[model samples]
Target chain A: MYQLIDPILVAVLLLNFAALGASQLRTVIHAIALQGVLLGVLVVVAHNEFTIWAVLMACAAITLKGIFIPRLLFHAIREVSIRREVEPIIGFIASLLLGGLGTALAVLFSNTLPIAQEHVGSLIVPAALSTTLTGFLILTTRVKAITQVVGYLVLENGIFIFGMLLVEAMPFLVEIGVLLDLFVAIFVMGIIINRISREFSTVSTRNLSSLKE
Target chain B: MLISQIIVHVVLLLVMPPLLLGVIGKTKALFGGRVGPPLFQAFFDLIKLFQKGSVISSTTTWVFRAGPVVGLATAILAGLFIPFGGHASPVSFSGDLILFAYLFALGRFFTASAALDTGSAFEGMGAAREVTFSCLAEPALFFGFLVLAKLSGSLSLTAMLDGPMPNSWGAAGASLVLVAASLFIVLLVENSRIPFDDPNTHLELTMIHEVMVLDHSGPALGMILYGAAMKLFVMCALLLRIVAPFDSGNIWVDWGIFAVGMLALAMVIGVVESIMARFKLTFVPTFLVAACLLSAFGIILLLR
Candidate 1:
């Protein structure tokens, strides 16, 4: 079970790169969905002992983050008719390099902090920081609202990864609450995207500045 | 024992490359639902090319001729530094990995220089694209080597790849997987395969490796084809050593396994070519950079 943890986490990290390097909004969404499913598996694997709560948590996570949220984003892309292009503010190559740099830094930064004895060799710290940094990168660098929403979801996935370290301290109910909050957040973002696209005839956040002054 | 292994390496290096190309062609044909050329078609083509006459352009210099010769020489030399299926390389030193890498570089330099010597704009463009793309690819190759060096604690290609490789896989499996992925990308790019450059395409504007050799004919073109196939073989051997680093205590069996692995890899390349469309010229650099990131991530994973 412990051996399974790092590979799943490493896969999640690779998906971070896939998202950063991808030009298609649909590709980015799939990457996040895959990351979500892998993380859901990580939730079960990290616990060592199988508990009813762990299994239940994995099921909810797999459904919401993996299936439910991504399905919402796919529909959003379809109805909004944003097509496939991500319209990044920076080039894909530059964004990929920056993502690499952030991941290296995340690993470096996590090395300095003291971690719990059992969690020391595990990739939990570096994976969490790296995933968060990747999410932040997507959020800041991309111009599309759908991409930004995907970025926000990725950022939240990073938090969920960190939350794995404190599986005991982080109550199952709290976990449920976090997932529901994310679900609601996406629900709101979807509505905003539909409304903005309907009003402006585009999803590029670059146009939103006209409301200023 | 060393002499025997070296003989086996030399024989395979000489004889096996064309067959690999044949396998790739046959695999692609199967995918396209046609009965392609026979499995030995590459060898027949090479024989025909060598028997044909040369047609040098009036504008060309000696560099145009030197390109294929130098390329073939370097590729054969590079093959010496790579172990064939757990057998130590014919030539191994503390820092042969650098030599191994630069041999390919030197080969590319000469090839590009030869293309420029022809003074044709299309060949020149192909040469420029080849050199430019290699700038990204060469570093990614080094990064993959870096992972191997760190894992095995040696700078030599033989030491970096042989014996305890299975153990290294056990300890650093994720990093190895990343390295394997990047190296596959490198292989495709370096050899000018489909998705990077269509080897089969003769259209000047659309090809890279084929376009550069527009002036070469007869034996020179044969040398280029043979060199390309051998380069693929060597690169595939490097990849195989990492992914399947097992020695069954019988030399013949080991060699057979390595040969089968090379054939399988050729077929896989065929499948990739069939399924994926070639990238636009502008996106090629982006693809190369992604390869760099893959290997860089391999190093990062190893650091932890």
Candidate 2:
């Protein structure tokens, strides 16, 4: 069970690096969506048992994270007509270095926590932490509002990775509720992205600062 | 048996680097749909260059002539410390890894000085860029060394590399992977390959290492080319030992594996050069920093 999931988790960690390093908005979105799909698979694999609830959660995760949210982001970018995340507050290389540091910290931090016996040596917690840190990195370093939305989705994906550890303890209803909340939040953010682009003629949050005065 | 192995190692080191360059050219040619230069083109060029007389600038001192000589000498010296495959190095001791690293630095110091000796603005600029990039690349190489030191619990390169049995890969595979990846980047940067600097470019403004040698001619340039190839060979040998840590007990099999691994690595570098454009000079530091982070992460993984 672990042998199957660990590689995917590592792949998730690498995708985080890719998303962090990528200069194109489109690449970041695709990397995040692939990460979401991988997390959906993680949901099934972590359960080990083929429960109906596990299958349902996997389906919901795949639909929302892999298909629906990415489409929304693509649509938003097309509507905004911005292809690159240029003029980032932090350069791609520096962000990549920070991402590496975050991965190291994640590994170290995961060591301090008590873990389930089955998942003790596994990379689940560290991968989750690293993904979350990378998401936070993207959110803080990039000026694009749409990229920030992608960052939030990545953070949510990290949360989903961590949430997989509690599959037995948590109820399925709560899981679906969390997914629904993400969908609605992104839906509203998509609308806001459109409004911001329309009102300001640019999606850069730096320009939005002018309205404060 | 030891003497034969040493002879084989030295011979292979001398003969293989130019071929590796050829293989890279061939691979790039294949990628570009051109027949490119012949496989022995580097050797032919070396022969042609060595037969010609050097052109010395009056502004330059002996340092200009000494640069390629010292560089080639240091590369050959460094080669003595690096073990090929499962065979031990010709020279190895406690703390030799430090010397191994500094030997390359010593070569660079002279190479840069020689470039500066020419008193040309372009050469000086190339020398500055070379030193700056090496500053960033050095830490990545050391961090990778740190990971190896921690993994094998030794400071000696030979002991550190040979100590990792096949079973060790299973235990610390992730760390090894990170180290290998980081070392590969270092290899590329140190060799001034694509993504950091283009070796094929003749444009004075865009060149990094090549620009530094723009004034050298004849046998001096030949020495530089040989030195560059030897340096590439040495770095590639270091990477091969890590990535292909297998030992078949028979010395011949081990050498065979090492040879194949080095060629494969050259081919990989060629493919990388083919597909990716060199990073802008501003981004080169970022790329090197990423290499450092990778090896740093490897050390972190080992420590935990």
Candidate 3:
């Protein structure tokens, strides 16, 4: 059961990194939604126990991450008329290179840590860590505010993957609370993007430089 | 008693904010030319403001009213897990640090949202800058925590501290120094101290954290100020745990040393604030990126 869940999650995480390395706005949001769905499926499959709460959590994940968020973001993208994150401070190739380096580092670092739990599956820690780094890479390197939001979502997803390793230990209430906070956070980011677009006439954070000393 | 732990955590989490501010202020004053106010000055100020009340902005909604409360609440809530002086945290579990870190992010997210809610360009600029720096700083801070967890064999801040001090000045010492440097940068940027944004800066155009709080007054202002200082205190405590000589058994000595260390650290921050000019806003990100590189180096050293 652990082995089956691990590879699919790793593959999804890698795709999430690949998405971060992409330049198009539409592609990035879609990738984020895809990540949400992948994570949701992973949750259900790994637990291998079908309960109403679990199903509801999975549904909530799909609604917020897979559908609602991307739809809201795409609307904002259309409203702002900005289709691409052009000329990110780091080029796509460079971001991908860093992403690869980060993945290698994550695997290497995880190997060094002493593991106490015999039943614990491999790959979760490294996958989560690399996905997190890739998300940060996108966040720092991108000029677009929208893209940064995507990066943040990816980062949160990576954290969620990390959380799955200790799902039994972590309270369901806390999980619910985290998901609620994340949904609200993304909603707030959508609002901020709208304001940024209207005020500066561009969603590119590069132009919001009027306040710098 | 579990109940007592809960009570103590709650009280400390709430009251310590103002006390932390007072300590920071008094230390800064001692470092400067003049005498500072009493150690309880922030506490007094809060009482005064709470009694006096506030004038709501016309441009704002319920978000404005709820923002400061949420910020303060979240800060106090996150504080519940920080584990003062090797006391077991009220909440502890796997990946608790992620919650610890993100709870602060939760406060920040709300604070930024509230800042943007005001529709003031100055506040918006401040929010943008805060989030931008946080984007870089959060990872560095986490990476540092990661290394500490790795070295110590535990992720809980308390357990990590409970682990053996990395013997000698090798990779462990290097990483400790690296993490401390990065966390200190976070303390500055997150707390809105000098070289990042001057807490006492008169100019709104040059402010990040301060500018966001410009429109807030009375108890709301009190909460923001208190929250930032307590956060600084928490970071100081984490640093002390890293550097302190005693292990978990000598709680009194460890805490006493922590308090004294925090006082000295506050004075150092004050002296730095007194002497240095705020960096150009663009340079703030550069500064944070430098911290990230340091943290990355620390991790690489640990791996090697």
Number of the top candidate by TM-score? 1
- Tens-place lDDT per residue, model 3, B73-108, is 777777777776556677777678888899889888
Model 1 reproduces a share of the real contacts of 0.62
* Residues forming the 10-long window of minimal summed lDDT in candidate 1 chain B: B203-212
lDDT, candidate 3, residue B195?
82
The residue ranges of model 2 lying beyond 4 angstroms of the native Cα positions read A114-119
> What fraction of the native interface does candidate 3 get right in terms of contacts?
0.00
Clash pairs for candidate 2:
none
* Candidate 1, A80-181: lDDT as tens digits: 877655467888899999989998999889988899888887899999999999899999988888999999999999999999999878889999999999
- Native-to-model Cα distance after best TM-score fit, residue B141 in candidate 1, in Å: 0.6
Q: What is the TM-score of chain A alone in each candidate?
A: 0.97, 0.97, 0.93
**Model 3 stretches with alpha carbons more than 4 Å out:** A1-213, B1-10, B165-171
**Per-residue lDDT tens digits of candidate 1, residues B150-216?**
9989999998998679899888999999999999999999999889889988975978888888889
The sequence of per-residue lDDT tens digits that candidate 2 reaches over residues A99-142 is 99889889988998988887787788998898899989988889
Predicted structure 2: lDDT:
0.89
How big is the positional error of residue B271 in model 1, measured in Å on the Cα after superposition? 1.7
Q: What DockQ was computed for model 3? A: 0.02
Cα lDDT for residue B19, candidate 2 = 92
